[model samples]
Target: MTEFIPPGTCFLDLPSPFPMKRGGALHGARVAYETWGVLNASRDNAILIVTGLSPDAHAASNAGNREPGWWEPMLGPGKPIDSDRWFVICVNSLGSCKGSTGPASINPQTGHLYRLDFPDLSVEDGADAAAHVVRELGIERLACIIGNSMGGMTALAFLLRHPGLARSHINISGAARALPFSIAIRSLQREAIRLDPNWNHGQYDDERYPESGMRMARKLGVITYRSALEWDGRFGRVRLDSDRAEDDPFGLEFEVESYLEGHARRFVRRYDPNCYLYLSRSMDWFDVGEYCADRAGNPGDTDTRAGLAAIHVEKALAIGVQTDILFPLQQQEEIADGLRAGGAQSEFLPLPSPQGHDAFLVDIARFGPAVAGFLERL
Candidate 1:
């Protein structure tokens, strides 16, 4: 019998010699996760929640605190996820800066931080690791898997890699593969970190961190995650009281610039530059079709339809924002279409919001109903 993991934050040590996709491995791999609600007698009431970049396993309020989590608006007793009816499990990604094992963790072999030495990670690796957690928890199948952005990618990977493990999937603003535009933007973000003098090729001291590069990268990310419409409506070239004449050339006059800077400042303190590099690269390299092709005796094929057809879920839902330039509505539509081609029931819901790629985070009113309806049916 599998061990029953209690509700709250905890760690699951993966079996020894965890092999990675890029031919690298970790000896003492561990995954951090959090759980809510009780597992039913049938062990089929579990819901796996895969988060986007930055969020940890803390998906909602628990015994530790009553404070709202990043997804608090949609997860609660009577909320969309309805913790009272389902057991929700959220795991930190393998290469994250959170409590999970990542670049920030000590290398068991070297007695030092993994830093750049951490093995390359892929979305499939994250999915496999999370699967181990589910198995450890004694769950034979998941009622549904819900993911957003990077989490959405992970959800697809999970379904592809572990056939029939989940009964349903909800992908929110995720893509089968990264587009050139996104790849280009992320490459620039990585460049900013690499060019930082203090970066020292990923060997900088903890005290003298690469703040400038990280801040710039974060600023760029904030711009891409939001829409021009939102900026115009929210900031509208409004000047902050602290704006200085000498800073005009640097574009600090607008309140929007100040907002980005404030967000960057807060992010730099919490995230590690090395972790960002690894995870960003991983997303760029992910291609669900590649995995699907390998499963179908064509290791080098690029048939997207063939790949999506491998999923064995009862139903799937893809949600997208109208202004989501990062992943876009077309990508979500493609997911729905691909799933249908693969012989699964699928639905596509494109929402109109100025919030862009981050709409799912900001516009809960639009997402809560769509997600709740899907889950309730399952």
Candidate 2:
């Protein structure tokens, strides 16, 4: 069934008022988004549902290409997101091609694809655009802003950039800054794309779409998202396709390789190459403290422990999955600590799962109750 979308919601595409990181301004800076539930008269029942990389505004609805929405399991009537009570909004980030302004869009000046010429996007810009969306929707304040992975980073950025925008935020599997190891991994992925002759420096207008390179990059990303322990337990030494022939390749002759290839193929088909490069680069440059020290623009100064101590909240909960290697438990703990220090009611809970960073999607039984309990108390 098509993911249920509440009635009377509208999609908005607004122009960006600022220049992009790589120079030039977008003429019609479109942001694909969806809204659900009612505004509760006061509009305080709104929840900003931030998305991870690649997915679009169809966070909980059927997409144009018959694709199931990303967070379908968690977003419906009476689900964790509870569309019946809370209004929700999800927008495709600025640099994504999934119905958002990105390299795939036509450049107004040249009337051609932006491609490599598309400017770099930052998480801050994502936050800024989201803030604009909320405002355009006539929501003065958000009850909570929830995000995962890059979406988590954007949520944190929202807290930092627009103080008091969200009463609370739930960030899942993300860090304030991308680690050096992450940088190296993304660099290698970028190399894979650039090395592919078909990429043609992001100028490929062909059908194949650097599939091999994109697949390799997705494989690398999947490896990092999980851990050796999980991979070993799930498919250790398993035969590929249940049997291998003499002509079968050695590396992909294993079940795990096939599994990774499946994920890569899906990712490559759904996501764009230049968008991947720009989004990965945004992650690389996402140090919360980078612009904060100068005070010109604080990207991580939403409310430090000392800063939060002054405010009051009914209740708060922070959750981390044990198998999530991408954003370790330590990062979630740090967020919990910040909330507590800010004097808001808060607690950190860790749940065990084998799904790695994908645990949030797969292990919702545990997460659902935790979030529901916290919300109930509030």
Candidate 3:
């Protein structure tokens, strides 16, 4: 499985023998990243954007690649991210197949694909990789670090691991830790992939790819990415054509089912199942509470709260959609409350968005002003 390197994506060679958070190391590895705007003379205007699972480094259009990015609506000149005012850098997560070294990447020593042989990945490892990218670019500290969904977890780890490196943060639809429900959902997704006979223990090729497993996994994910409200509103219980339904009594009965099937099919071949497995498992293994074992001052505090309080950003904003089942609203509230306890000016905003965890990417009209106002005040 070849990694998907986006056009115009930039690469940063990681330090040789780059140690993984768990055991094992990569002799030669690289991170994929893309930047918008320019760092000012003072270099205090640099901002970093870490992504959720599956997103590439391209966050928006640039001279090198005119194609609009996944977050094209939110980032650009005068947009919410306001590239003209700040130098924005978005990095593909380290364990991702999007131009970053991951399971899909070839092993340097063996000259064979890493596949399942890749070292165990942790959210902290991604944080460390992102930090290296910023430092390599000559930015001593970032104005802000923005994260979405899994990237939210990475951002939290980034802050805790490297205190004072980013002055502020905007955590959108992110969480301090993976909730049990999220873990359960991801477990099912992974199970779907592994159970596919075509997976072949992560050794399948194009001719024998795990399409069924990948489709099931992606469909399950897509079902969770948005809310039931959005589903009902977008595609009620509308049935497909009677002729089509008659052809296969058990297949694609409703509009929603068709939507999911179409979406899953589109994604199955675009992303490597092995990479998906690695990234999904990493989220399950991450727990911010692990860092709070020794913090004694906050009596009766949960580890999640105590750990979040240990971080020291000067200012922060944690946003969550009201309908987000994955990465619920409470997590964002906890982030704000905990950051406030640590003396950062923090606030949590819960929007009445029906898009669920993916609302930050859509519903820009509602999210745009909130982000712009925060950045403007900075």
Candidate 4:
């Protein structure tokens, strides 16, 4: 009989040492995940949700809790995901600071926190870890694999690495590879953390964390995650306090500046700096074409189409936001085009939203229909 895991957060311990894409292996690695709905006897009505850079396993509320999730707007009994019909599983990324094994987790080898010592992680590693969870649940094939941002990259890696694992794929604001501009922005985020005095080369004491650097890094990230169009429309030279003097230089003069600071402060309290470094670097190194090349005769070639051509899913949907400067629409177009070239039924939907890359999270009205229609067709 299949072990019944209730609808809530749970941990899946890897039975043996987990191998990474780079050299070395992780011992006692565990993945934190959450499930919603019920799996039928066949265990085929399953959808795996891969999160972006910072989400935990809690994708949506369940019987145990009622709090809205990060993507709560699009996940519910009657939402786009419709938890009542499909068994949904969301896994926290491998190198995240959540309940999953990460830089903050204790290293079995030395009985100390891994910190920067955690083995380098890749998008493929995240996919492999999630795949293990699927097998542990006795699921042979997934109804669909859904991903956004970094999660989208993980979905691609899963499709390329473990062929026929999923019947369909839904990629939202994801890319085949990290672009140079995104890499450059993330590099600055990492630098901010490293430059902080409290960082101490990633060896700071528990009480003395690198809050300033992490805060600044998150501030920079917020800027890139949205577009200037959004800022102009939402905050548009609006002062935080009308009574404040226009010449006040020491305090936050604009509403946008305060907004960024608030988000950064909240992020620093929840995320570990080293884990951020590892996850960000992992995204920078990801290339679906590289994974595709491994199956081809010449592994060194940079043929993106050849890599995309390897995906054998029954259907695929790639959604892009017009103002998402981070991932951009061009990358989504390429993904759709490549999948079609590979003989898979593919559709590309471009959405116009001032929210930019984060439209999938907040602009549910536009994203929900597109996602729901695709899943319905599958």
Residue by residue across 1-378, what tens digits does model 3's lDDT show?
556778999999999899998899987999999999999999999999999998999989987799999999999999999999999999999988898899999889999999999999998889999999999999999999999999999999999998878999999999998999999999999999999999999989999999999999999999899999998999998987754655676776788988999999889998999999999999987777776753564444448887898999999999999999989999999999988988899999999999998999899998999899999999
Query: In model 4, what lDDT does residue 78 have?
Result: 87
Question: Which pairs of residues clash in candidate 3, taking residues 3 or more apart in a chain or in different chains?
Answer: none
Please report the TM-score between candidate 2 and the true structure. Answer: 0.88
TM-score of 3: 0.97
Q: Write candidate 4's Cα lDDT for 98-179 as tens digits.
A: 8788888889999988988999889889999999998898889999999999998999999888888899999999999989
Residues forming the 10-long window of minimal summed lDDT in candidate 3 = 293-302
Clashes of 4: 0
lDDT tens string, model 2, 121-173? Answer: 78888888888899888988899888788887787777767777788777677
Ranking by lDDT: 3, 4, 1, 2
Residue ranges of candidate 3 with Cα displaced over 4 Å? 245-247, 294-302
- Candidate 2: regions farther than 4 A off: 1-10, 21-23, 62-68, 241-243, 248-251, 296-316
**Total clashes for model 2:** 2
Give the local distance difference test score of model 4.
Answer: 0.88
Worst 10 residues of 2 by lDDT: 1-10
lDDT of each: 0.87, 0.73, 0.91, 0.88
- Specify the poorest-scoring 10-residue window by lDDT in model 1: 1-10
In model 1, residue pairs whose N, Cα or C atoms come closer than 3 Å (at least 3 residues apart or on different chains), thus clashing, are none
lDDT tens readout by residue for model 1, 41-64: 999999999988888788788775
Evaluated with lDDT, which candidate comes out highest?
Answer: 3
